[model samples]
Target: MSDTEAHPVRISSHPAQLQALEPVLKKVRTRVGDIPALLALAEDIGHAAPKPGEGSTAKLWELLASVTAVDVAAGRALEPHLDAVAILAQAGVEESKPGAWGVFAAEGPGLKLEAKRQADGNVVLNGSKPWCSLASRLDGAVITAYTEDNGRAAFAVNLNDPGVSCETPLWTSRGLREIPSGTVHFDQVPATPVGGAAWYFERPGFAWGGMGVAACWLGGTVAVARDFRTALAKAAENGREPDQIALAHLGEVDRIIASVTAYLAQTAEWIDAGSSADSSNAWSEALRVRATVAAAVERVQTVVTQNLGPAPLAFNEAYGKRMADLSLYVRQHHGMRDDAQLGALALKGDRRW
Candidate 1:
């Protein structure tokens, strides 16, 4: 499509979905921005993208739909940046900072960031962080670090500062080529405290953010499913009638897509209703939904790949990229480890789930 002719990606499945996304989509068309237009739309939405005490799940899902529609891999990169901003807002950290600032909180154990309290009570960070997506380009980040007292606390660090350095993004092997996702090293970087130690995981928004990532997974799977839809349509176009097996597989793909859509809606309703008010239960709930949706994504991938055969992967650029991108993205949830943790969370405490 020509620049003047291009329309906002038609990825949303319903009117409410379209309604929630129109504001960002409109701005995306008019403005030239550093991030992708999809992400520019998200940064425009800010805290409005449905979390605790924010917008509804309907709005949040719309953003994910539009994002994945723009590009499956790029949306994963957008998720963390948006999640960091939402978390900071939810925690009231850097509330005064303005503009399209992006953050990546790649702070979950191993190769830690250390926080030292200066004489004036200001905080500085020192350590190496891995999987810091968009670190080289983002305005700032709220990263987890070990404090002088040996506790985990989150410090909001500005990447523009001299003390912070992001390693060259080397994701050529996996898929997400557009995203500069890589490692970051911090050396006495000045920062502001988001909250006291353990605040990052303890906040109710953590689970909410996790579910947002799941929404991205669901959206990307939809993209993959669409490729299958196109293949079937083309088969009909060429007057090559699908045999019984191809027809059956197409039905399976539709069934999986329908199931995932319904689950996403249910999740959206619960999020708007504030079922995630409690951090503990919310974490388990996020895990359950993420795991369930993760399984659904896997099913969709299997159905799409098996039904369409090897031709799409070898010949179709769009389909191949979506497959590779989603294959790598969904692994972020891990295969068995996440499931085991979900089980442990469910059984360990009457309050966990």
Candidate 2:
């Protein structure tokens, strides 16, 4: 498809009603052969453009939850595009650029998103968004733009709209070309607000919104492990000389994956118990999760590259794409660099350390 045409990808509306979503979920797993296309759509347009078939907000959330859950089930990673949409929705913002570096992975104020509203209540947006993970293939995008009311508003816009544009200027480093991370420009695009000013950050789910990255990171980590195991098994059958160093790296990757899973489970439980508000514990846990994921991803990438012998990186579409994809995906955790600070804060216990 050309850059001008709207790359159509409709989300199901009855996503929350498990029975209704099962089929779509299955379809996504088997049919997602063109990730770059989807990324381009999401990054350029937005998730809400075409309006999902399952119109209910609950259904949309259900669809997202199902996607993430299925990612967990199938040993596949939840596409960052989905995580981006969920994060924006949870923030109660009218629009969100899902791909900004730390927006999905850490604490502090997230990406600075700007949306514009006209006197007629028609919103127009103009801004450059980074890390729009699947920019090339999204039908719509929820973005944050400023309004005459002097407040930040969130809304969804269609990428196919004349106002929206995506530039796949550079592909992320992770050997995977499926997710084309790039900049998206919005110029006088029409948008629908999500809630209100306070709603953007005041929503109950705002804090946990950033945590979705951890889940995606975990999923990518799993993929790397699975890929490596398959490669290892194949090599053994061929009786090829195995690289002891690479084998050690694989073992390390496996251990890190296990640790990441444990950390995520703990984090999820904490989120369920409403403990995420305690910035001390919450941020601390998030930092550790981030660090663990980064390490795990690095190990997996290294092992895979070493074993694949550069052939995969240069040619194998799936394996190469996965590597590139994972590399870019793991970069989201740089926010974890502050884990120590969170730990220190935890020690203060309301004393304002």
Candidate 3:
């Protein structure tokens, strides 16, 4: 592709959905460091975005990618909200209130949150849950806790509860500064159970949600690649022809973007076609797609930085932030550990090829 035509390719087959999200994403760009405004914008996106596995899974991922391309921090805040909405729908629970939601399922080495069943059949959560992103800002969240029987279950709880407390000033990451992930403590906080024991992980939507994160990585990388293209285009407009090495870097970027986009599109189609109905298949697909996209994102970053040199990183605010945010965000893929898990699955006859 020529410099002028080297923009990130659209992964969405549905034009209407993209059109609908454009305005909301515009608001997201304006809301940059404003957490409350960004959360509200996430709600707007939730209204327009499709729930995964309802036949437009590819469109859902496309929406995520488009948001990340606009602003990585905004995309970071929006993803879990979208995932929570999908999880609620899958669990057949009608959202009691309309507000931004988050999914807090990450377990830590410290005290595990416990769910105690009350005599009235309600459940109350106690102890601390780590890695609860935007917990202080979001209205509600779907959290996982261990029940009395030592089984795990997903519960929906109101963050506004008097018993809920989030540890602020704890997330010290330079990347995605707007979205601070911290530990949230619950003191007899009442919660409504969403799914049964082990249902959260067993559900196909779990894998789909993980893949949604990969979509964000893809979008952020696309934005980085666009910066490189924009720089080359400017150079060309100034009567400067890019050297053979620069052209070679652009070619590699184009190839990486195309391959990752096609992989995500295919995975999204498979999800909508019920190919991920089996839990093992769903996780396998998610692992492969996430690892593939994460590696592609790293390559694109390397090529862009190598070709553009340190000028952009030192002078361009957007380019620098995109690079930092993507670098941190994609690390959620767990690198070789995920590869090891996939290898273990393959050992169990999970191979498709």
Best by lDDT: 3
Give the Cα RMSD of candidate 2: 9.1
Q: Residues 284-350, candidate 3: write the lDDT tens digits.
A: 8899999999999999999999889999899978778888888888989899999999999999999
Question: Candidate 2: what lDDT?
Answer: 0.52
Give all TM-scores, in the order shown: 0.86, 0.63, 0.95
Report the backbone clash tally of model 3: 0
lDDT of each: 0.70, 0.52, 0.86
Q: Model 2 segments beyond 4 Å from truth?
A: 1-32, 35-81, 84-117, 120-123, 133-136, 146-153, 168-176, 198-204, 240-250, 277-284, 303-315, 335-353
- Model 3, residue 348: distance off in Å is 1.5
Write down the worst ten-residue block by lDDT for model 3: 1-10
What is candidate 1's lDDT per residue for 273-352, written digit by digit as tens?
87768888778777887887788789888887888889878997767777888778788787689778877876787343
Best by TM-score: 3
Where is model 1 more than 4 Å wrong at Cα?
Answer: 1-42, 52-55, 95-103, 107-110, 349-353
Q: How far is each candidate from the true structure, as Cα RMSD in Å?
A: 3.8, 9.1, 2.5
Candidate 3 runs further than 4 Å off? 1-9, 12-17
User: Which pairs clash (backbone N, Cα, C closer than 3 Å) in model 1?
Assistant: none
Instruction: Report, for all candidates in order, the number of backbone clashes.
Output: 0, 46, 0
* Better TM-score candidate (2, 3): 3
Weakest 10 consecutive residues of candidate 2 by summed lDDT: 1-10
